[model samples]
Target: MRYVGWTILITFWVALGAALHYTLPQRDVVRIVRVFEERQDLNDWTRIFWSRPDEQSDTFISRDVQFLQTVRANGRPMVYRNEDTGWSWPPYFKFDTSNLFTEAADATSTRAAPEWYVITHYGWRNEFLTIFPNAISLRQVDGPDASKGIPWVNIIILTTIAAIFYAIWVRWRRFRRARIDPTLEEIQDSWEAAGDAVSEKRGRIRRWLDTWKAK
Candidate 1:
C-alpha cells in the first residue's frame, strides 16, 4: 500500500509537469530552412494538435495549415505548424498566421549563409503521432550562437502557480490547527469525563450493598 501510494503521487506530478511543458510557450533558436502550406485532414486523433480558426464552425474537419522548417543549433531538423490559436487554449491570440508565414518565408536561408531566428512557440512534436508544435511568433537573430535569454514568461507563470498552492496549503493548516484540532480535543475530554463518572457511581453502589449485608 505504501509503494502504491508513492507511485500514484509521483505519477501525478510527472503528468502535471508534462502538461505544463506542452501548454506553455517555449522558444527555440534555429535556422529557417523553408516555409510552405499543406492541406491537412483534421478528422483523425491528430486534430487535437491543430487549431480552430473559426470558433463557431465546428463542422469544418480539414484546412490548409502553414509550416516552417528549420534546423536547430545541433543540426537537427524541426518543423512547426503555423496556425491561429484564436480564442482557444494557451490563449496566444495569434490571428496573424498569414503574416507569420510570409515572415518565415523571408527569413529562409541556406546552409552557406544561415540566418538564425528565435521561434516562439507552444506545444510538442511527436514523430510517431505526426504532431508538430505550433509556432506562435518568430524573429531574426544574429546567428545560431545567439543567446536566447532565460524563459521569463515560464518562470513567472510557474512561480505564480507555486505561490497560489502554497498559500492554500498554509491556510488549510492554520484552519485545522486553530479550529478543528481544539474541537476534537474538547469532544475527547468530555467523553473520558463521562466514562469516569459512570465508573464512580458503580463503585458507590457496591459499597452501599456491602454495608446492608453486614447489618
Candidate 2:
C-alpha cells in the first residue's frame, strides 16, 4: 500500500512536469532547413529551405543548391566567401567536411549575398540532417531527435504511464497473495518480489477466502 501510494505520487509529479513542458513556450529554437534533394543520374540538385523562429511557413534559399552544382561540375572544391573568410572542401565527403556549409566561409563570400543561404546556425542545420538523412527533394518537419541530449516530453509521458500500471499491478498482486497465503509478512515479501502481478479473479477469490476464514 505504501509503495503504491508512493508510485502514484511519483507518477503525478512526472505527468505534471511533462504537461508544463508542453504548455511552455519553446525557449530553444526549433530551426531546420528543408534541403530538397533531387538525385538524378547526371547530377544531384538540392534546394535549401529555412524557417524562422516558430514561423508557420519556410522560405527557400539556393546557397546549398548552387554550391552542390558548382562542386559537382568543377570536381575541385568551389570557394565561397563566408563571414569574411575562405574555406575549401575535400575531394571526398568526410564527417569534418559535413559541417562546412554552416561554419566556414570564403573570403569572397558576402554575408548578405545569396550564396550564404545555407550558412545559418549549426543548430538549424543539424535539425535538417536529423529528419532527412536521405531526403530527396521536399519540405519536412523536423521531428524530435533523441540523440541530441534534449529531454523529450513524449518519452517522459510514456514512462509515467508505465510506472502507474506497474504500481497498480504490484499492489493488486500483494492484495491477492495476502488472502491466499493468509499472512501479512508473506504478502509483503511476495509483493516486493513480484513487482508486476495483478489478476481480477485472484482478487475476488482472495476476498471470498478472507470472508470464509473470518466466519
Candidate 3:
C-alpha cells in the first residue's frame, strides 16, 4: 500500500508537469523557410490539440489552418500551426490568425541570408498523430542563435504556481497539527482505556470461578 501510494503520487506529478509544459508558452528560435495554409480534419481524437477560434460553435469537422515552416539553428525542421485561442483554455486572447500569417510571410528568408524569428507557442508536435503546436506570436531576431532559453514569462508563471502550492501545503499541515492531531490522540487514548477495562473484568471473573471451585 505504501508503494502504491507513492506510485500514484509520482504519476500525478509527472502528468501535471507534462500538462503544464504543453500548455505554457515556449519560445523557439528559428528561421522561417515558408508559410502556408491547409484545410485540416478535426473529426478524430486529435481535435483537442487544436484550438477553437473565438469560441465558435463546434460543428465543423474540417477547417483551414495556417502553418509556419521553419528550420532550427541545427538545420532540423520545425513546423507550427497558427490559430486563434480566444476565450479558451491557456487563454492567449489571440484573435489575429490572419495577421500572424502575413507577418510570417514577410519574415520568410533564404538559407544564404536567413532571417531568424523567436516565436511564442504552446503545445507539442507529434508527427505520428499529425498534431502541431499553435504559434501564439512571433518577432524577428538578430540571428539564428538569438536565444534558446525558456521565456521569462514561463519562468514567472511557474514560480508563482509553485509558491501558491507551497502556501496551501503549509497551511494544510498547520491545520492538521492544530485540529486533527488532538482529536486523533483522544480517540487512541479512549481505545486503550477500553481494552484495559475488558482485561480487568476478565481477571475478576477468573478469580470468582477459582473460589467457587474450591468451595
Candidate 4:
C-alpha cells in the first residue's frame, strides 16, 4: 500500500510535467525548406494530439493540415503543423492558420541561401503517433545563433506556478498543525484511556473469580 501510494504520486507528477511541457511555448531555430498541406485522419484515440473545433473533435473525420517542413541547424528535419487553436486550453487564440501557412511558404529558402527562422510552437512531434507540434508563430533571424532569444514568458509562468503551489503547501501545513494535529492527538489520548479502563475492569473481574475459587 505504501509503494502503491508512492507510485501514484510519482505518476501524477510525471503526467502534470508532461502536460505542462506540451502546452508551454517552445522555440526552435530551423531553416524552412517547404510548406505543404496534406489530408490527415482524425482518429478517436489521437484526438488529444490535434487541435480542432471543440464540437467537431468528438466526431472524428479527415481534414487538410498545413505543414511547415524545415531542417534544424544540425541538419535534423522538423515538421510543424499550422492550425487554429480557437478559444481552448493552451489559449493561443491562433485563428490565422491560412495566414501562417502563407507566411511559411513565403519564407521558404534553399540550403545554399538558408534563411533561419525561430518557430514558436507547442505540442510534441512523434513519428510513431504521426503527431506534429502546432506552430503559434515564427520570425526570421540573422542566423541560427541569432535565433537564441530569452524565454521571459516561460520563466515568469513557471515562477508564478511555483509560488502558488508553495503558498498552498505552507497554508496546508499550518492548518494541520493548528487544527488537525491537535484533534488527532486528543483522539489518541482518549483511545488509550478507554483501553486502560477496560484493562482495570477486567483485572477486578479476575480478582472476584479467584476469590470465589478460594472459598
TM-score for each candidate, following the candidate numbering:
0.80, 0.19, 0.89, 0.90
Instruction: Give candidate 1's error at residue 64 in angstroms.
Output: 0.9
lDDT of 1: 0.89
Better of 2 and 3 by lDDT: 3
Give the winner by lDDT: 1 or 2.
1
- Model 4, 1-215: lDDT tens per residue? 99999999999989989998999899999999999999999877787899964677657588888999999999999999998999877788888988999999999999999999999999999999999999999899999888458888889989998999899999999999999999999999999999999999999999999999999
Q: lDDT by residue for model 2 over 1-215, one digit each (tens)?
A: 99999999999988876554433222121222221234222112322222122222124332232122112111232222111111211111123333443332231232233231221111111332321111111111232231233345446756886799899989988887877556767778899666545566678889999999999
Best first by lDDT, ranked = 4, 3, 1, 2
**TM-score, candidate number 3:** 0.89
* Candidate numbers, best TM-score first, in rank order: 4, 3, 1, 2
Whole-model alpha-carbon lDDT for candidate 3:
0.90
Q: Rate the local accuracy (lDDT) of all candidates.
A: 0.89, 0.35, 0.90, 0.91
Candidate closer to the true structure by TM-score (higher is better), 2 or 3: 3
Best by lDDT: 4
Candidate 1 residue runs with Cα over 4 Å from true position: 1-12, 183-215
lDDT of 3 by residue, 1-215 (tens): 99999999999999989999999998889999999999999866888898975545267788888999999999999999998888887788999988999999999999999889999899999999999999988888788778656568888989999999999999999999999999999999999999999999999999999999999
Summing lDDT over every window of 10 consecutive residues in candidate 2, give the lowest-scoring window.
Answer: 82-91
Q: What lDDT does model 2 reach?
A: 0.35
Clashes of each: 0, 12, 0, 0
Candidate 3 collision pairs: none
Index of the highest-TM-score prediction: 4
Worst 10 residues of 3 by lDDT: 52-61
